[model samples]
Target: MSVPETPSTSRYEISENPEGGITLNIHGNMGAANAGQMIDELTALLSDYSPSSLTVDLEKVDYLDDFGTLVLAHLRKLVTNGGNGFYVINSSDKIKELLSILHFDSLDEKMSIEKKRSSGIFIRIGEATLQHISDLKYAISFIGSIILSLVHICLHPRSLRTDDTIRYMQRVGVDGLPIVALISFLMGLIMAFMSSVQLEQFGANIYVASLVSLAMTRELGPIMTAIIVAGRSGSAFAAEIGTMKISEEVDALFTMGFNPVMFLVVPKLVAAAVMVPILTLFSDLFAIMGGLVVGVFMLDLTAGAYMSQTIKTLELFDVFWGVLKGGVFGVLITWIGCFRGFQVRGGAASVGQATTSAVVSSIFLIIMCDSVFSVILRYWG
Candidate 1:
């Protein structure tokens, strides 16, 4: 009959012609669960009659999920990469929505999304890093203020010779001795035992004394003492000054015509700078003695040999430089703590924040300065 011919109900229709090679049209949902079987059938068909071009007519696609989208993408890529062509014609809005979600709208223009992601991730990170650097810079500027304060006092010699000096010395030096001794002794004992285990293997047990003395005098002693006093005395300085600042006592001092810097910052600053090295020296001596105990008892090295070797290896410059580094770190620690405390806003929260920031930032600055000194010593010493 010359009646209208009905379209084939087959999901895929293939045709071959004498003039051209082959064409395939697929219709229906070939999502993840069914995409595998669909691809297998399509590949089998393609192997039999390798087509020069493939056109997928998606006009009748009711919907597509991730699987169906992936199936189409892979076939398109294969044909395009093999010097063939792939075309999608008459896609429905429903299929477009799925493709859009997979970011397949413009396959060739995806560098922009990658650029956006890179910006979004690392740009925020850069801002955070810059903020930290700014905070550190502000802390460094505080050191300049201290130098100016010293120059002012230098012009007026009467300022340095005061009871404040003696009182501050007692607080920072004598009051700090017990804690320094305890920490140093324990540290030396730990280092000696740990080093002994390794050095004993090489039958160089006597070198344990050298290791403990060098480490204490050169590195561990100064760093550890600074950290302890920073936690102990630095926090105290902040809280005490912050309380005075909040309670209007600092205002009273100004009203009485007494310079608050001389009464407060100068005393604490001088105290920390002077006594931090003393504490570190104490730590070095105690730690060395602690290690000596282990050397005599376990390593069978006499106290005379241990002490002689220690003196022979340790230069006066090593001890002096360590103390100087301790002094510098101490000054920074106290200044920041007091400055942070004085700059506090609000109430208890601000106090807590200042105290915590003082400790954490003091530790960070201590570490940074240590690194700088290490680098300098590597080249200079």
Candidate 2:
């Protein structure tokens, strides 16, 4: 079987060799524009004749770019995989040099992944351990920087950016009030209703106020506000700074001789620390009101009695302790959010990952810190 010769205008010629193989005589200027046509013609001839072996002659291919090289490389793979011998002959130094640069001749075999590999349990554990250690070191370093910035501001009040701090305070605190109040109120109502059912069986329904008051002021109010802020403000911080980092704005700050920590992070930190406590106080008040609603309606307690019981049950220390927890949690949330943001190294997808990490880390740290406070207060109080 034989193939027709190429016309004068054609850049490639196909012919059949009597020795049971086909020869492709490629000519000048193979590039992106004509590479597709070359491949199609070669494919058609290969399919019609079904050559046992194929050889591509490239002596006349004066200029070969990456695209043309890639097309030819694919042809080689197709011939070899179909149980036929494939050979390239008569190439100049320029073509060879370009092929070598791209490693086009061996691209498929190098890139082929026949099967996915899974790591052993121990190997995965080791990798995870190392990653966490690196992350922990980063977190510590970030915390140190924040503390240093705070100290510097304290020593030189004029250096602090008060305007940014106030803006963030309004955003992180005032903007978040509605949701915080709603969640806290619902939490208190549920707690009171659940406890009232049990307390009523014991004919101690009035103690419902005591339970709601103590739980909200000592634990729920601070923790709920912190979690809300983590989801709201912490994630926002990470996303904002991560976007700036990816867009090279953070680098521009460095070029302008601005400390990013002092300029960007300190205001957020101060605002969060200052406002979280105030939000917690609001949360506590709203939660108590929710419990009062339950006590008056569900528990059949008079309004005055519920108020009297709540007041007697809650101590100044309990309220102050919750507010203190709020302040500490505020620091954790803001620091983790900013730290994750600064850790962003790549493009838009990295910013997304950093935002998620910030929210998750802040929530985790808040719960852990609350646990520690619970343990210490158990012993101290």
Candidate 3:
């Protein structure tokens, strides 16, 4: 079988061999100019022809280049893919040298691509277990490092980054104030309106103020403020540190004999711990004002009556307890945020994952800690 010759390129003549295989005899130049056309014609001809073995006879009077080598590689792949043997023979020393330089034999090995198989459920579970264990170990270490950093800061107050702390305070507390106040006020209004509906039936409408004030001061105020801060400031801390981590800035800090935790984490921690409690106080105030609005308008109670009831119901201990919870939640948020940031690996995608993880972990910790506090407070009372 003869392939129709193209002008100024190689052509192939396939001849039956004594071994019941086939020999492809090529003639003319086999360079880039002819490579594309040569491969197409060869592929079309060989599509219908399969043999036990195929031999490429390249003894033709011509030159060969990388593109020509690629054509031969393609033919080898086609034959081998059909579970047939492919061989190259009768090349000049120059052609042989070029083939050797290109490591043409490696092409056959490369042609067989290996596919990855998915692991079984047990294997996946085991991998996840190991990963979690590693993460937990890292978390413990990070916590210890943070404690040490705090101690160092206590010893050398001058080392604290006052400017960064103040900036974070503005970001975490002041910037967050409007939204926190709005949410708290709405929460209080809803609570008062709902409670008044039940209390009005029994002539106990004034007790609505007591419910709003006590709930806001003792529970809702600190928890709600912490959640808002987690969504805003916690994610910001993670993203900032994650970016720095991926950019090698964290490593640079270590190389310069600076503790990354002290330099980066401590300021944010201080800012959050100080400001979140203050924010909680504001949240409680707004929530009471919202309740007062509901009481005066909906319940037909005077502002003085509402305020007097609220003050009578809330104790100094209740306010202090909420502020203390706020401070604890702030520390948890900053810790988790910075921890997730330090855990980031790879690139921009890892930073995004870290940011998301930080917010979720912070919120979970906040709720868990709040539950523990509830148990403690219940028993203490």
Candidate 4:
């Protein structure tokens, strides 16, 4: 093949081959004379295509001195700084040898990149998991303290902080009513509507009331309310407690001989235990009411008939089961929230992260616990 010789010594011919990207078939020795010139020319070539990546082939080149190395490194930096990608292929033996010496060989470089990326992901996930478990552990410890305090209070009823506990009850229970009402009512309405649509086709539309009431009262109402509370109150409690923890207020409480569990945690737990059942009752009532509305509108069934059907299908066990589930959910929400709060030991961001983790972790545990309860009851019954 005839060599296509160019007039300009500084600038080299660049053929964009579809088979390979940026094939730079080097002819002569790459040195000081060629280096600066190539850099200027290559810089211009880069401004045009702006490819996702650039591949510089050195297979045709007979030799590459140190100056050539400088140019290649500079090119790489340029592409990266311009927010474009870069790659190298068809390295000559000399280039490969130099790369090996400089610790930039392809095999090692690729392996290093992979290791860094994988380790980063693994580290992030591991950190999240550890943090969650740590928060859970703190929550369990707090509960243990609360249990001890409760035993103490039981023994010395006169020393009980009745007034503070009462106030906590008001906050956790009464204040949470509106949100619980709306969500539970909506869930019931949705269940009723969907059930009525299908059951009406089978001429079983009257059964919609039973379906809505039984499902909500037995399973959905308490679980949904608990999950919501975990999201709302659990996070708030964590943040509040976390802030106090990071600020060393918890230490101060200990120094002053006041039990942090009694001062902060027990109130929330007791309040939640009481409030959850109340909310569950409200949820069951709202859901039934919602089903009743659907009955009147869609099924043309009288409220009396719908209520009668619901009563016939509903069992006392179902009501007790729902309340029991709500109690478990309540314990979970309070435990998770208080635990997350006590686990806080950093800045505001840490508190925020702990709060979010508490909510997510609490919800997961509640569902799992509820599922376990259901399975056991089914087998027991």
Candidate 5:
């Protein structure tokens, strides 16, 4: 049987061979313009006749492009998939070279794609352990660098970046004041109101001022301030240094005979250490005022009596302890932030990850340190 050409740019004649296989004689251009229609028509013919084998004669074809190569590949795949032989013949040297270049011979073979197997649990555990060890080594090295930098600055006071330290102080302290104040005030108000509910039942409403003052001066003040600073300044420190790290600015500093740690980290560390305690002191004061507001209005206590109770309840040691904790938390925050920044690799995405890690690590360390302090205080008191 002979098949006539359709409106497609490519034409092909299918004839049943005497040997019981079908021969496809292709004519005209076998380029992208007719590749789709050619594949569809050829596929339908092959399916209808269910030929035992297919022989594609490319001798009459005028031109063949990559898309045409695809049409040939498609037919080869279909025939082979149906357990029949697919053969290409009667090609000019040009067509033969084109097919060879396109690796048309390999088109009939199935591709082997190896899928990766999941690692065993023990292998994952080993990897995690090694990663933690590597991180610990880096942490120790960074801490040592920080200490050496501090000593160098101490020995040569003028070597310190006084201007940068001042700038960071303003950024960490002054800029953070409003939010710190608002949060501390609200915290104090809530504490006072809650304590008043219980104390009022026992006619101990006056103790609300004492409870608010003691908590703010000893515990809540430093912890709350540190958390806020971690979220704001800690993330900023990581992002700033991480960007510098990825841009090779840190390397540039090292090449210029500058200690990257001293140049970049020291100023931030000093600023945070100096300013955080001051911020905590302010936090305590604002919280006291919030409690006073609650005491005077809700508890119907005179402002003078509330102030007296607060003053009488709080010792100077309590204020000093909170400030001390704030200073420690400040150092931890800046150190972790700068360390995470230095750990950054690759591009902008790494910087964002570093910033997030810095905040989370700082907060975790702060709470952990606070717990230790609580244990020590319990024993000491």
Candidate 6:
């Protein structure tokens, strides 16, 4: 090794070692005053030389500050990233301590890659299949429980709570009358107006009476009334019973040797079964009145003529089937509501979820059963 005189300016001496590596010796004060120059010189050296390994000699450096430490750290990073081994030799204790605290010595060279899993079609299909099977089982259990309860009530009539049943009927039926009538009347008006546009083209506007009457009696009347009751009474039943269940009142009833189903559910079921059909009849009448408004005003038909056409077109079986559909829908709404309520666990949030579920489930069942009725009536009639 040859000793060289101290230099006035910051500079570097690059040499090719016989041991198959390159050495860069930095001399003079490496501080903020000459940090930029040092970085520029290092950048030029990297462009000029291609070395398999690099050894940096820092022993000749007189002083090193935070900025100079940053430059050296950046240069070390460059050398290691170029597929070469980087070594720092003859570093003073102060320089080593500063670099150690800056975490430059702990840089990880290995890259981390994330692996993603693909969602396959068969996996999704299998999950859906299992969910549907679970739902079907739940439905079967609910239906069985309802049937057993009803049969028990039939065999033991005196055990039925008539007062509770009447009270529920008043709440679910009489209180719901004005809104149900209003909606049915609007629906009939819309149906009559829309149908009359096409019917009037052929000068057959008189048929609007028959169209609204038959549709209201056989299909719209029961369906609309049931949907209204499901939204109103079903959600109420779920929320009320769910609150009771959550508050432990239902458990108290059970502890007192009372049949919760017979006491709580049967009255609701009976009330719904009794009131819904009556509501359906009222819905049909209101809807016909609305159709009469369109007929007498828009179609310029006589009230007598409209009533006569409606009477002639609407048969006894049409009203019977509509009322039957109403009864079935009522039972479905009440049972599902009470069932969901009984299923409640936890707090008020669970009660709210149960109430929402009851309404949604009742509506779905109503639509499905109505479809089945349509199919059966098509074939049977």
Off by over 4 Å in 5: 1-49, 53-74, 83-104, 107-118, 347-349
Q: Please write out the lDDT profile of model 1 over residues 192-253, one tens digit for every residue.
A: 99999999999998899889999999899999998988898788778877888878888899
The local lDDT score (0 to 100) that residue 295 gets in candidate 4 is: 88
What would the per-residue lDDT of candidate 4 be over residues 203-250, giving only the tens digit for each residue? 998889889989998899889888877877788788888999998999
Q: Against the hidden true structure, what lDDT does model 4 obtain?
A: 0.78
lDDT tens per residue, model 6, 1-381: 212234346878889988767898998777766678778878887777778788989999878767677777767777777778888899989888877876656644432456787679999899999987976787678778777878998998888899999999999999999999999999999999999999999999999999999999999999999999999999999999999998999999999998888889999999999999999999999999999999999999999999999999989999999999999999999999998898898999999999999999999999999999999999998
Task: Give each model's clash number.
Answer: 0, 0, 0, 0, 0, 0
Candidate 2 worst ten-residue window by lDDT? 1-10
lDDT (0 to 1) per candidate: 0.80, 0.89, 0.92, 0.78, 0.92, 0.89
Which parts of model 3 are misplaced by more than 4 Å? 1-109, 112-127
Point to the candidate with the largest TM-score.
Answer: 5
User: Cα RMSD (Å) between model 6 and the true structure?
Assistant: 12.0
Note each model's CA RMSD in angstroms: 13.9, 6.7, 6.2, 12.8, 5.6, 12.0
Let me know the TM-score candidate 3 reaches against the reference structure.
0.75
TM-score of 5: 0.80
The local distance difference test score of model 6 is 0.89
- The CA lDDT at 74 in model 6 is 67
What is the C-alpha lDDT profile of model 3 across 246-280, one tens digit per residue? 89999999999999999999999999999999999
lDDT score of residue 180 within candidate 6: 96
Q: For residue 337, what is the lDDT in candidate 5? A: 97
Error of 3 at 13 (Å): 16
Residue 159 lDDT, candidate 3, scale 0-100:
93
List the candidate numbers ranked by TM-score, top first. 5, 3, 2, 6, 4, 1
Better of 4 and 5 by TM-score: 5
lDDT of 1: 0.80
